[model samples]
Target: MELVKIYECLCDPTRLRLLHVLAQGPVCVCHFQAVLGEPQVKISKHLAYLRARGLVGSERQGNWVIYALPAKPSRELQANLACLQDCARGNPVFKRDLARLKQIEPSCAWVRAGEPQKAPGQCRGG
Candidate 1:
C-alpha cells in the first residue's frame, strides 16, 4: 500500500520485467513461465511477490491461475504501472518478453481427452 514498498518491489529486474509483460493483459502463470523461460517455482515466487505488494491479482481459470493487475489499484500504482509500460517500449528485455508472449501457444481452456490445445484465444469460436 505504501509507495516505498512499491518502489522496493520494483527494484528487482525480474519483477520489473513481469510487470511489463502483465501490463499487456491477464495471463496464466504458465504463460509467464514459457515467455520468461524460468522454472515454475521462480516465476510463481515472483508472481506471489507482486501479489503480496498489491501490484497483481489472480483468478482461477479452470485449473490455471490467471494473474492480472488489480481492477482498482491505487492511483499511484496505476501511474507507476503506466510509466513502467511506457518506459519499456525501447528496452530490449521487455521487447523480447512481449515478442515471446505474442508467440506463446495458447493452452486448451478445457481438456478434451483427445483434442490438441489451440493458441490463446483460439479456443473461442471464430
Candidate 2:
C-alpha cells in the first residue's frame, strides 16, 4: 500500500540510478546531472519524487545542494536497498555513471572513506 508507493517512486531507471549514486555519499545537484548525463530539469524532477517519498535527504553546502540517503534507514528499507544495489551493480548505465562520478571530485566526508578521487569535469558544482 503506502510502502508500495515508495517502491514505485524508485522504480524508474533514472531515479534508481540517482539512488545508487547517493548511496555512495552526498552529491550536488549539478554533479548528479553530470554523472548521470541527464538534463538538469529531469534530475530535479526525479529528486523531488524521491524527496516526497522520504527515501532521501538533502543539504545545502555553499551554493550547491547535496543529497544522500537517510543516516539510519529502517531495517526493512535497508535490506530492500541492499538487494537493489546488487541488481544495479551489473547495469551498464550504473557502471557508466559510477565511472563518471569518479572523475568529478575527491571523496568527501559525505562519501565513504577510502573511495578514490573522481576526475575533473564529472561534476559541475563546487
Candidate 3:
C-alpha cells in the first residue's frame, strides 16, 4: 500500500481510535459499538472505510461479521500500527478504548439458531 493512502487513513481521529482497538484482535460490530459508544451506522461506516483501504478485513461468523487487522499487513502498515499502539500509551481515550474492549462481552447472536426450549429442563436427581 502507498504511504500516502496509509497517511490519509490515519488522518481521522475515529479511524485512528478504531485501529487501536482492532490491533488487539478480531471483533464484531457489536463489540465496536459497545466500546466506542457510537451508533451502529457510524461505526460501520468507519469499518467500511478501513476495509476499503485494505487495513481491516472481515469474515462471516454465524449471524455475525467479525473484523480484524489485515492478515497480510505491509511492512509500512505494521510499523505505523505498532507506532500508533506505542503512541497511544499516553492517550487516555485510546487507553480507555482498549480497556473497554477487554471487558466487553461477546455477542450471543449464535444461540438463535435453535429454540431456547431445546435446552434441558432443570436437572433432577436420577
Candidate 4:
C-alpha cells in the first residue's frame, strides 16, 4: 500500500464514507444503499475504486457482495483511517451517516447467510 494510493482513495467523500462505515464491520451492498442513500452505481463505483487500491475487500454471499476493510491494513492506511475517524467527528454528514448505519445494522438484511431476498428494483451488480 503506497501512501499516494491510500491518500488518493481517502480524498473522495464517498470512498471515505464507505470506509467509515466499514471500520465497524462488514456490510452488504444493499445495506450501503439504505445507509448512504446513494444510487448503487455510484456506491459500487467508489467501492470498486477502493477495492482496486487494496483499501477495501469484498466477498460474495449469494447474490450480495459484502464489503469490508482489509484484514491486515498497511501502516499508512491504519494511520490515515484513524485520522479519518477523528476528523469525521466534526462533520455533520459523517455523523449522520454513522447514525444511520447504527440504526440499520441490527436488522440489516444480510444478517444471516442466504437471508436477503431481493426487493423489487433493488440494485444488482453491474
Candidate 5:
C-alpha cells in the first residue's frame, strides 16, 4: 500500500515527462523549466513531489541543482519505467523535449561537458 502511493506519484503526466528526461541523465532545474515551458514555481512543486516519493535524486553544483534517476531502481520500478519509456517514445512532446535538451547541452552546471549559458536569477531549491 505504501509502495502504491509512491507509484501513484509517477502517474502525473508532467512528472512522468520529467522522469523521462531525468532517465537520460541529471538535468538542471532551470533547464527543466525551459524544456517543460512551465513556470519555475510549478516545476519546483512537481520536483519536490517527485523527490519526496523517492523516484528521483538531486545534487547541488555551485548555483544549480541537477536531478537524475536512481542508479539502481527497484525491479518493479525499473520495469514500470521501461514500459513508460516505450509508450513515450512516439510522443511528439517528448521528442521535442529531447531535441531541446540536446540543443541546450550542459545547461545544468553539474553536466559533465559543454558550456551552458548561466541563466539569470538566484538558484531555486531542488
Candidate 6:
C-alpha cells in the first residue's frame, strides 16, 4: 500500500482502535461493537473505511464476517502497525479495549460455532 494511503487510514481514532484490536486477532463486527462499545453501524462504517484502504481485510464465516490485518501487509503498513502497537501499550483506552476483547472472545458466536478451521487471526476462545 502507498504510504500516503496508509497514513490516511490511520488518521482516525476509531480506525486506530479497530486496527489495535485487530492486531490481536480476527474478530467479528459484533466483537468490535462490544469491545469499542460503538453501534454496529458505526463499527461497520469504520471497518469499511479500513477495508477500502487496504489496511484491513474480511472474510465470511457462516453468517459472520471476520476482519483481520492483511495476510501480506506492505512494508510500510507492517512498520506502522508495529509502531501503533508499541505506542498503544501506554494508552489507557487501548489497554481497556484489549481487556474487553479477552472477555468477549470466549462468547463470540463465530468462534463458538466452530468456524475458521483455517481462519487468519483465528478467534481465540472457542
Best by lDDT: 6
The CA root-mean-square deviation of candidate 6, after full C-alpha superposition on the true structure, stands at 4.8
How well does each candidate superpose onto the true structure, as a TM-score?
0.80, 0.82, 0.81, 0.84, 0.82, 0.85
> Which of candidates 2 and 6 is the stronger one according to TM-score?
6
TM-score result, candidate 6 = 0.85
Where model 3 places Cα greater than 4 Å from the true spot, the runs are 105-126
Per-residue CA lDDT of model 3 for 1-126, tens digit only, reads: 398899988998888988998887777787777787788898899999999989998886555577889888999999999999999998989988887766653233232232222334221111
lDDT of 5: 0.76
**What C-alpha lDDT do the candidate models reach, one value each?**
0.77, 0.77, 0.76, 0.81, 0.76, 0.84
Choose 1 or 5, whichever is better by TM-score: 5
Per candidate, the number of residue pairs that clash is 2, 4, 0, 0, 0, 0
- Residues 55-82, candidate 1: write the lDDT tens digits: 9988775556778888898988888888
Best-matching candidate per TM-score? 6
TM-score of 2: 0.82
Error (Å) of candidate 5 at residue 23 is 1.2
lDDT of 5 by residue, 16-72 (tens): 889888878888888888778788898888998988877888887666777888888
Which parts of model 4 are misplaced by more than 4 Å? 109-126
lDDT of 6: 0.84
Q: For model 1, state the Cα shift of residue 72 in Å.
A: 1.2
lDDT of 4: 0.81
Which is better, 2 or 3, measured by TM-score?
2
